[model samples]
Target: MIKKAPVGEIPFAIAGDSRIYVTAFVNGSDSLRFLVDTGASSIVLNTNSPKLKGLIHNGELADNLGTSGENSVEYSNDNSVKVGTIQYDKAGCAHIPYPPEYWDGVFGLNGLAAFNIEINYDDFKIYCYPKETLTVEDSYVSLPFTYKYDVPFVHLHIKLNGTLHNLLLEVDTGSDRIIDLNTPFVNKNNLLETKKPFAISRIASSDGGSGELKNVFFDEVIVGPYIMPKVAGAFSTLIFGMQSKENIDGMIGNNFLKRFNMLIDFNADKLYLQPNNFYYTPFYDFLVR
Candidate 1:
């Protein structure tokens, strides 16, 4: 008989704009708030945090790039890192620049990959289960996904004008926008020729790099059995060096994902979606004027 591992649930605080934050303990002493980001590949701590004193510095610099810009991070290892009742010994961590005022660090895929995680947007809680014991309900829509550089990518179909085209989209909870499409995909599909009006906006990366983007609204986007209509998105011609290796078309961000309670099974390569209370909530176009 297979042994059953204990499941754990951790409550998270939601930002006004839908960012999720959870409290974690480092070395069993300092309690810090960390943003749960599926888009990030590793656990990232703020260099300025007092908890850094408890970690053993590895002396190697790790480089990370985001829409904000590139940052050189310091590598470290902790004896014990705990989230609720689950704990990881000798956990690897990277000390990067301090995040925004609301967050001190990021709980990333490096630590999260060990278990199946469910982000319950409706209840502001995270359910975690060992890979062997987790199971999905019949009500959930299960979609197959692939990971590139530790980031999850899912297939989605968008109707442009009258034609439906399948595209690969990254599941990026760290991104606040609804969707961001690369210029190559837009040009190839002649998306600019659509009748929908677009607005020019400035897009910024985590490292403060800025670029211009054309924001537009799509009438229909299909993900499994769900149809998301009147979705807002942006098209960017600027390509980051890190993205060159990724064979993806766009990214699906929090503005669209917050509508559902999501279960990401990295081991099984599946993404499970269950629409929540926010399913019908109006899309907020904070990035566009």
Candidate 2:
């Protein structure tokens, strides 16, 4: 018997800094992290990495425009990627012969659209809402914020070291990981140690310049009373676009959002997040204003 997926919940996972995590198998191997990127038209390597062999190939190169509007060349292969129990037949991706410098392969929207997914950036969690029942509370609510606009991100709060450190965080659905910081924010907080370095790769700026990749451990990241332990983040030194003028420490991306059920009510000046488990408090209310 063919069984249908449960309702209200989407099948998805996230990994890396703030990227969506997809459990995909390469060449009948175990599932691994496939970063979800909506902005990318196709997938490519950071520079030069062995993972290139994992991508299925049919001998075709494609031209791509990067985030900074630079032309990127790639090759697509016909490979089947398995996520969860569902297998995508004829799955194809752009193959980079070598990762640029410090880059990793991403599973962009073309790969993710195969499944129905909804993510709440504010809660640092994404709910696999049951397809059978759709809740009405998913609508937007205005939170008490100094800003006059009723934007979705204005209400999320940032917590540092497991404590509310009075830092501002922007919830970006477009981002793949939980938290990604700009150079200024990292420097202002003195968060990085020059002697220590970690290797990570992603899509670089249009100019083909290196994107800063650093490992970070926050004692805790708290938003609306939700706490994530041993969280990792990125510190980007490259100024790809206009510097983040929002003065935010970083962005809250899907890496964290895929963990729980969230309710955002902007009109009430509060955001609610309910944990999947009972040991923790179900409701987390935040006062943005």
Candidate 3:
């Protein structure tokens, strides 16, 4: 089902051992080996990284725990961060958790959000263009959702026997599978009607925290022009705070994204969903490998 969505690949490079790193730029200056994390709300760095010592302002001790479950008091402040050809001046920054073994820091939406992002998994390269200036020559559609830090999320509003329910979902690029729900939507829906619950396991985040997984078999889940039927997700009532809103329902992750071609315009705050043939052909062959 995911294969039917638009897909592409790029020849992206990853650095570091434990933490895969990528390159970045700030004000056109070279900055290297930044962690690429779609799950993080903002860019962050280790206090010991050469990049953070002098560039950060108003640095303060802050407590942070990510999907990895590593707890640490890292610095939270503002700074200019660069990765490859992209840079963000006065971007938000936080501390890298734990002893900081592998990565210098993470390159998150706080910086990437400034530009239109085009990730070509087929080519393994990421392109950053001015979001405010780009125009779509191609015809596309946009799904409705509330965005926090430029990430698109949907609220699962389900109905059963005249009763209605709702849950917020984050569309995640970093997640490997689909249907990560916090509050097992089916469990509630089942209570209204007699049906066997789909068996699911506990799903873990990149940070290593686990949540109750529930299979959501929806008549139709719509985003843009694409619709997913009987999609599976995790019930994540406990991890709602991981997203901008608590009581969040679930997250749409790679399992869904890999299905379609995607265009994200950060500066303009627009997202365009196009057919796979138009955007994914160049790198589609590679993705199959």
Candidate 4:
């Protein structure tokens, strides 16, 4: 017999750039705003975060690679972390460099692995159900994914230069832009030759790095059963320097995902996409906003 799982609902607020944030209590003391980042592997706390007060530091060190470069970070263990009615004891966390204004930390997939998390972008709420008891609706399109270094990767078919190319993309909810391509994929496919001159723009990386990216209109981008036509993407070398065991082709960010109400089950290796009311909404250049 399968065990029944508990259900929890947490309210989330949208940042100016459309990033989702939730307030979580650390060690039953300080409450901090943590970005709900699916792209991140582990829970990351800013070194300057006030919530770091009572956590015990562990001697393990890790390197976090971003658009700028790599930063060496340390790990810590907290007695308990409370998110809504759910509590995790002896939670492992990464202590990284100071985050930007209005952001204290990142709540990643490792922190939410026990539950099947549903991100209701339309309602600004997060519904979490125990993985065993969670039931996916028939309207949802289930996409298969593989986890590497605690990050989720999915295969997407995108039409570039009238040829359909299968690309492996990271589902990055923490990113504001629609699509960010890596250098190898861009060079191998000769994407620059077909770029739109008028749509080129400079983009700022999340780690305070900056690079040039050109927007290209694709004939179609198919994610699971959904088809997005005339999709816009930013081709850049921003992620070329990042260290990864897998050869990642690019990333799929919030601008492309916001149109759907998503459910990500990391433990089960499944992503469910249900098109919301804004499914057909026009895509804007959020990087410039």
Number of the top candidate by lDDT?
A: 1
**Model 2: per-residue lDDT, tens digit, 1-289?**
0023333332454334434555456556544545545444444333344444444455465655432233446555666665555555666676543333333456554544443344444333333322232234433332332321112244444444444465554444345545666567767766676324344546444234445556555555555555555455666564544123335445455545445444432234333454443223211121122
lDDT of candidate 3 over 177-201, digit per residue (tens): 5555444443444441432335554
Q: Say which prediction, candidate 1 or candidate 2, comes out ahead on lDDT.
A: 1
lDDT of 1 by residue, 1-289 (tens): 1124338777887676667788888765578888888888888776666665545355477777665357676777654678866688888887775634646678888878878888888778887777753466777888898986568888889876667878788888876667877667877766776644557767665454666667787768886788987677776666663232236787887878888889887778888888889888777644344
Q: Judge candidate 1 against the unseen true structure and give its global Cα lDDT, from 0 to 1.
A: 0.73
lDDT measured at residue 204 in model 2 versus the true structure, 0 to 100: 49
In candidate 2, residue 53 scores what lDDT? Answer: 48
Off by over 4 Å in 3: 1-21, 24-35, 46-58, 62-73, 76-80, 88-91, 98-104, 148-151, 154-168, 184-209, 215-220, 237-240, 243-247, 275-289
lDDT of 4 by residue, 1-289 (tens): 0124337777888666767889887765677888888777777777666666545355488766664355667777654677777788888787765644646778877777768788888877777777753456666787788875457888889987789989888888877778777777887778787777447766554344566777877788987777888888877755434322238777888878888888887667878888886687667645247
Q: Whole-model Cα lDDT per candidate?
A: 0.73, 0.45, 0.51, 0.72
Candidate 3 structure lDDT: 0.51
Model 4 clash pairs are: none
Model 4 regions lying over 4 Å from their true place? 1-6, 50-59, 100-102, 133-135, 197-210, 243-246, 285-289
Q: By lDDT, highest first, what's the ranking?
A: 1, 4, 3, 2
Better of 1 and 2 by TM-score: 1
TM-score of each: 0.86, 0.44, 0.62, 0.86
